[model samples]
Structures are given as structure tokens and as C-alpha cells.
Target: MTQRLLSFGLGYSARALARRLLAQGWTIHGTTRDAEKAEALAREGVQPLLWGQDDIEPILAQSTHILISAGPDEAGDPVLNAHGALIREHAVRLRWAGYLSTTGVYGDHAGGWVDEETPLAPSTRRGQLRQEAEAAWQAVPGLPLHIFRLAGIYGPGRGPFAKVRRGTARRIIKPGQVFSRIHVEDIAQVLAASIAQPDPGAVYNLCDDDPAPPEEVIAYAAELLGLPVPPAVDFDAAEMTPMARSFYAESKRVRNDRIKRDLGVALVYPDYRAGLDALAQDEAGE
Candidate 1:
């Protein structure tokens, strides 16, 4: 049987996974809100379906796997709100279902470690929504749900090199504030591995082995670009949007042992240095 995947939101991370699956002859149907992005997806060989504008029921029926990257709103997960019933009806046919969640759902661990077994106690509204969304998806009976709690995602055009080159990168300093992050390509491989070995109701934390302070990452990026390290600014004194400030509200080192031990997945970029190196090399090559 031909494998078909229907992705709720074909954003950066999901698109990376779609690229891999598409190369393997998998049919990819992804949803996007923008017409231009729909054209972009089509250019990448993804069948683009506009959310809320296109009928997804038929697509859902034929999908052997589904990936939900759509974020939750105040009410709840948008996908579940609109197609929870449809997904429930077609649950039995789905070979695998993946939900992209965040490590924030584990809440602040005071720079401590949190694994998949950690009890969820989200500190922010965004984290709370993701936790609730995870529960809502797990509530759907017979759904082969797999939850991936991703740490900070960085790769390709999303890295800090741009800011470093533009001379606007700031080394935001908050005492003991450390974060775990994953390369986009690493996320893709983990998802592909999980698909190869389906484990329903499984939860995995997607992050690198190294969890370092935010300032250190900025400094490294500057060094990679051969630019002077950005000036350090105290977190309290720095002027930032509420959304950016909210990120500093939590500090945790998310564990990614499950993805390695369970799926036998090896991350291509194991740490920020390696990831940044590859990104720099890619940029240089381009």
C-alpha cells in the first residue's frame, strides 16, 4: 500500500519531514493559510490544501498517516476543533498520527532535566494550550497518537547567523537561564524513524544532547560568522516584546533519550556548535 501523509500545518519543521517522506515516494498533502505558500508547497511537490477553505474530510479518509502542527488557540487545537469528529471516524485507518508539541508543556524545571514522564505543569498560556491540546488528541479513541515535545527549533534560515551578520544580535543574560534546542533536520529524522516503527500513545522529547545558556549560543553564532560577540544585556534591563519575554519565564533541559533509545535515531547535529557549523557551511556553499 502506498503511504500517504496529511499534515495540518506545513510549517518549517513539518516541511522538513515532508521533504524526506516525499523523496521516499510518500504522497504528502499539507495545509497552509496563504495562497503564495500553497504555491510554494505545490512547487515542492506537496499537495496544498487551504485550511478552513478546503474540504479535508476526503484527504483525511485516504491518509495513512497524519501530522498535526497547527497550534492551539484560546478555545483549543484548531485541527481538533474543526475535524475531531472526522479524525475519530477515520481513526482506525490511520497507521500513525503525530502531534507537534513543545517542551514548554513540561514547564519550568529550574534548569533541571525533564523527560517524557515529567508531569505537565505549563507556566505560560502557550504552554498550557499545548498541554491541553496533547490531552485533547489523546482523548480521541483508537487514534495512533504520538506526541513530540520539541525544544527550541533552529536550522537553515531560522538560525542566529542572520542577526549576527546584521549586527543586531544581543546576548540576553538571565541568571541560570538555559534552553534545549534541536536542528530541523534532526526533527525530520526522528519523525521518520517513528513512522518506520509506530508506537501509539508514545511521547518523545526532541532536543539535542547539549542544553546551554542563551547567551552562549549567541556568542557561538557570532564567532561562527567571524564577527565580534554581541554585547550582553541583562534580561531585566533589555527591552523585549511580551512574547519574547515570555520565553524567559521558563528554564529547563529537556531530555531526548527516548528518541534515541526507542527509535534508534542518531541526530545529525548533536549540539548548537555542530548545527551552526553546518548552517555556516551551507551558507558558504550557497
Candidate 2:
């Protein structure tokens, strides 16, 4: 029997995962807030189910692979608050379940390295929320769960190139600050590899090999896009939204060795330079 896939919150991550699964011959059901996206999903041959507080039960019943990439508002998610118990009601039949989490859960490592077994000490509210959600799902008996701790997600048209093109690219510098990242394509590949061989109760840290200063990524992106890199801004001087500044506050390099060793996966975009270059070529109709 073909395994069924269902995703909550049809964000880029969910959609990317769903698209790959669909292409691999999985029966997929996906959720979207807007009517337009629902139509788009339908056009892509997914079962587009309009979602609300009460719409997931039927969706859960038929799905063997469940991906919860939706935010709490748009996808009835975080599962802890809304659907953990509800999902538990159908856990018996689930082959795999994955929750998209953040490396922010590791908090400020002061440029240290972290792995799957690192104790989670999330400094941000986002991290706390993710840990809470992870715990909630883990509490359910017989629930098949895997947690993916994603670094900053970047893909074509979604990275520093946008700011560089707009002349808003600030080569912001905070000496000693470093961050990790993953391209959406690589993210899809990791998830696809996982789905091919499900591993429950496993936690994976998904990031590329590069862990560099923010300025380096911005400059490389600008160069790739054939734009001038913006003047460097001191972290203290540049105005930053709390959300943006919160990013600089944490510094850690995440390891992807586990996924590679266990899943037999190799990164298609191993660094920002590679990812941006691919996007640039794609933009040029190559």
C-alpha cells in the first residue's frame, strides 16, 4: 500500500517537503489559509483541505507521514497547544511524524558546536516554544516522532540577494558572532531521505557545513547577484528589529554528520555561496 502524507501549514518548508513527497508517489493532503494557495495545491494534484480549528481530524486519520510546518495560527500547530492529544488519537497508524524546529533551541553557544544530543537551552521565545512542542508530542504514548532542528532557512529569492539588490544589505558585524544555515532545497532533500527510512524519537540538527559571520554571507550574496555589498554596520549602531537582533544574539555551529551518516544524504547546496550561485544561475535562465 502506498503511504499517505499530510502536512499542516503549507509554508515554504511544508510545501517543499510535500512537493518532493508527491513527486515520489506519496498521496498527500496539505493545508492552506488562503483560497488561492488551496487552489494552487489542487493544481499540483494534492488534496487541498481548507484548515481551521476543527479541520484536522479527518486529515490525520488517513495520513501515514505527517509534517507539521505550519505556525500555530495558520496550521493549528505547535501541536502541543492544539493537537498533540488529538494526534495521539491516531498515532497508532502513523509511520512517521516530523516537527520543524529551530537551532535557536540550542541558544547562545558562543561559537561552540552542537549536535543531536546537546542539551536544549533555548534563549529565545521561539526556542522555548519549540522545546515545549517537542515535549508535548513526545508525551503521547506510541507516537512516532522525529524532530528536525533547522538553522536559518534560505533558498532562491529568499536570501540576502533580495536586500543586496534593494541596497538594504547591511554587512552587519558582531565580532565573534557566527550562524549556520540550510537552503530549502537541501531541507527538502533531508526530509526526503528521512521519509525513505523513518526514524522515530530521533533528533537531527540540519545545517550546512558553513558557519560564518553574517557579513560574509551578505557580501557573497551581493557578489553572486552582481550587486555592491552594503557598507558594514556595527551591530550597536544599526537599528534592528528585536526579531532581527535576536538572531545575532545567538551563535553556534550545528553539525549535519548524523543525517549524512544515517540517511546517506549529501548536501546539494553546501554553503551560502553555492546556494546563491545556483539561484543566480536559475535567475539567468540557466
Candidate 3:
């Protein structure tokens, strides 16, 4: 049987995984809201179906794997709200299911370390929705669900280098405010590992080995770009939108032990510095 994966939303990380699996001969299909994005995905050889513009039941029936990268809204998870019953009915066809959640679900660990077993205490609305979505997905009977709580995701085009180059980077100094992050490629690897080793109802925190201050990452990116590092701005003094400010409210070091131990996975870029350096190399190569 040809391996087929149907992703709810094939955004950055999901598309990366799709590219990887596509090389290995897996058929890919996903949903997107925008017509332009759907066309782009089609160009990349991914079967793109517009949400509400097409029926997903047949795709769901044929999928051997399913990945939900769509975040929940005020009402609830968009995917669950739209297709929860269908997923439950097609559970037998799905060899594996994954929910891409955020480490923000474990809010404000006071710069302390948190693992998969850590209790969820989300301080932000986004985190709350993710936690609720995770629970809702787990409740779907017979779904081979694997939950991945990802940290701040950064990669080639999405890294701090772009901000530094564009002169929009800010070195916000918030004492004791540290954040865990992961390279998007590593996220794809972790997802692939989980698919290979099917574990139903398993939760894993996906982050790099290092948890450092955001300012340090910005500074590192500047150094790599051979540009002057942005001046420091105190968190309280920095002018930021409510959503950006909310990001600074949480301080925690996320651990990826479960992925390492259970999946036998090794991260390519284990810290921001390494990740930045790799991105720089890729830029230079390009």
C-alpha cells in the first residue's frame, strides 16, 4: 500500500515534513484557507484542498497518517470542530496521528526545566486553546495520537538573521527570561521518528538542548551576519503589541528527553548558535 499522509494544515513545519516524506515516496495532501497557498502547495507536488471549498472525507478515508498543525481558535480546534466525527470513524485507517502543540502549554516555569509529564498551566489564551485541543484529540476513540509540544520554532528563513538584516531585531532584556526553541528541521525529524515508532497517546516536548535569553539569540544572529547587534531594550520599556508582550510572559526551559530516549532521535542543531550558524551557511550557499 502506498503511504499517504493527510495534514490538517500544511504550514511551515508540516510542509517540511511533507517534503521529507515525499522524497521517501509518500503521497501528501493538506488543507489551506488561501487560494494562493493551495496553488503553491500544488506546485510543490502536495495535493492541496481548500478548507470549506472541498470535501475532506475521501482524503481522510485514504490517509494512512494524519497530522494536525492547525491551532485552536476561541471556539475550539478548527479541525476537530469540523471533522472530529469523521476522524473517529476513520481511526482504523490511520496508522499514526500527530498533534503539533506548543510548549507554552507549560507556562511560566520560572526559567525552570519542564518535560512531557509536567502539568499544563497556560497563562495565555493561545496556550489554553492548545491544551484544550490536545485533550480533545486524545479523547477521540481509537486515534493513534502522538502529541508534540514544540518550543519557539526557528529555521532558515524564519530565524533571527532575517530580523537582524532587516534592522528590525531588538535585543529585549528581560532579567531571568529564558526561552526554549527548536530548529524546524529538527521538528521534522522528531515527527518522522514518532511515525516510525508508533506510540499512541504519547506526549513529547520538542526543543533544542539550549534554553537561552532571546537577546542572546538576536546578538548571535547579528554576529553571524557581521552586523552591529541591536541595542538592549528593557522588557518593561520596550514598546510591543499585546501579543508580542504575551510571549515574554512565559519563562521556561523545555526538555526533549522523551524524543531522545524513546525515538532515539538526535538533533542536528542543538542550540540557537548552532542553528544560526547553519542558517548562515545555507544563506551563503544559496
Candidate 4:
């Protein structure tokens, strides 16, 4: 009775989750856009499939549980574009499906706390599209949809420290501006817990303990690199790309009490400090 776990758009957090599940002897299928990545995924024991191919129906048809990490591509996600008529053909067999969404859906909470019950008010096209994708999946009959609203995601190779070392760290200051975040490992754990015991149509906000201005993270990264902190720039003066600018448009402090109370999760990286310290020390070989 080994459960087969399949992930679409196996990137970032999903990559780690797929690895963990594979280690636990669960059969895994991960999707990627390129053949080389597909080969790499295969090395991890994942059956990798590319989207926009006729082959998807067979793959989607076999997955007992589907975790969508890809979100909607520029061309709109094939998962949403195609819908579940193909999946529905074998609906009785699919048990659980999870969609990784963003807290951006809550949109500009002005540092007010929010949780699963908060109504979505997205401020960006990405967030709007995510909501659309969620609705598309949920509309299918018998599809057990669980949405995880993720905060700023960081882990080993993808956090502020990496930006610091690469000389791209920017200390953008906006007084009282803060954001909640989560470690990729914690995301994997939350997904694991949800799969262990799912609540259909449940929405979980996945964020860690502290909500602090981005400047602090950047400065800490500078300290970890033993370099002077990057120069601060006011949000108004910073030259940001549309994609990056879009991130600053929303403001919120997300709550994770529900996940702790309900999923019984005691986060290993409770805050940025804990996670960053570990990364800094690991770099120093201490």
C-alpha cells in the first residue's frame, strides 16, 4: 500500500519534498520544462514529464496525489488550461491534490494578521492567476483540493545569503515594512503533514515566526559574509523590475499558529535568524 506522490513543476520547495518522499520509498513523479532537468529529476527517481505534450493525460491519470508547484506559466498552466477532464476520467482513484499559492493573495494587509479564513484580495497578476488556477482545479468534481498559501520562501541555496555573496543584496527600507517568511524545509514538512492527513478544501498559510523588514535580512547577510552592509535605498528610490516591484506593493503579517496547533509542527527554522545562522555557520565550517 505504498502511496504514489506526484509533483507538477518540480522547482524550489517541491524539489526538496520530492526528494524526501523518494527517500521514504514513495513512488514519485516530478515535472520540468527541459529534458536535462528531466534527466536530473530522473536521477532523483522521479518520473519527469514535460507539459504541453499529449503524454500528460496518462501521467495525470496515474497520480494518486498531485502537488502543483509550477503555478501558471506565461502561457497559462496546462493543468488549468486542460482542466481535469483527463484526470476526472479516473477521479475515484485520485485522493489528494495540493496547490502552492502565495500570501500575496491576501494583498496589502497593512501589517494586520491573517490566516486561512482571510478573504483573498490579490494585488498582482501572478496572484490573480494563482487564484484562477485554484478555482480551475477545485471546480472538478471529487477533486480534493488543499491550498497552501506560501510566504517568502528561502532555503540552502536560495536565501538572502546567496544574494549577499553574489553582490546583489539590496537594503530597501520602508519604515514599519515587514514580511513573514518560511524555510523551504518547513514547506516540505507542512506538505508532508498535509499529505499524511488531508482536509479537503482546506487552506493553510505557510509562514514562519517573525515578520521583519527586508533590510534586516540583507544586513544579516552582509554580516554573515563579513562584509559591510549594503547601502540602504528608500522604496521610492529603488530601481526595481516590474516583477520585483510587484512584491513591494503588498504588506502583511501572516499567522502560522493554526499550522502549529493543527499540524503539530514545531519548526526547525523558527525564524530567519535561526535559519540564517545555520547557513552562516555551515559556510564557515563551524
Q: Which candidate is the best by TM-score?
A: 1
**Residue pairs with backbone overlap in model 4:** none
List runs of model 1 lying over 4 Å from the truth: none
The superposed Cα distance between candidate 4 and the true structure at residue 220, in angstroms, equals 1.2
Q: Lowest-scoring 10 consecutive residues by lDDT in candidate 1? A: 252-261
Model 4 is weakest, by summed lDDT over 10 consecutive residues, at: 83-92
Query: Model 3, 245: alpha-carbon shift in Å?
Result: 0.4
Q: Candidate 3, which ten residues in sequence have the lowest lDDT sum?
A: 156-165
What tens digits encode model 2's per-residue C-alpha lDDT throughout 1-286? 8888888777887778878887878898887778888999889878887766337887788788888786433232455456667777888789988888888888899999999888999998777777777776677788788889899998865887777887877988899999999999889888888878888898888899998898998888777767787899999998999999989889998988998999988999988788888888888895
lDDT of 1 by residue, 1-286 (tens): 8899999999999999999999999999999999999999999999999988999999999999999999999989999889989999999889999999999998898999999999999999999999999999999999999999999999988989989999999999999999999999999999999999999999999999999999999999999889999999999999999999999999999888899999999999999999999999999999
Model 4 over residues 63-122: C-alpha lDDT tens digits?
A: 788888877856666666664576667555778888898888888888788887888888
| True-vs-predicted CA distance for residue 188, candidate 2, Å | 0.9
Best by lDDT: 1
Number of residue pairs clashing in candidate 2, backbone atoms closer than 3 angstroms, sequence gap of 3 or more or interchain: 0
Clashes of each: 0, 0, 0, 0
Question: Which segments of model 3 are wrong by more than 4 Å?
Answer: none
Mark the 10 consecutive residues where model 2 has the least summed lDDT.
Answer: 71-80
Q: How many backbone clashes does candidate 4 have?
A: 0
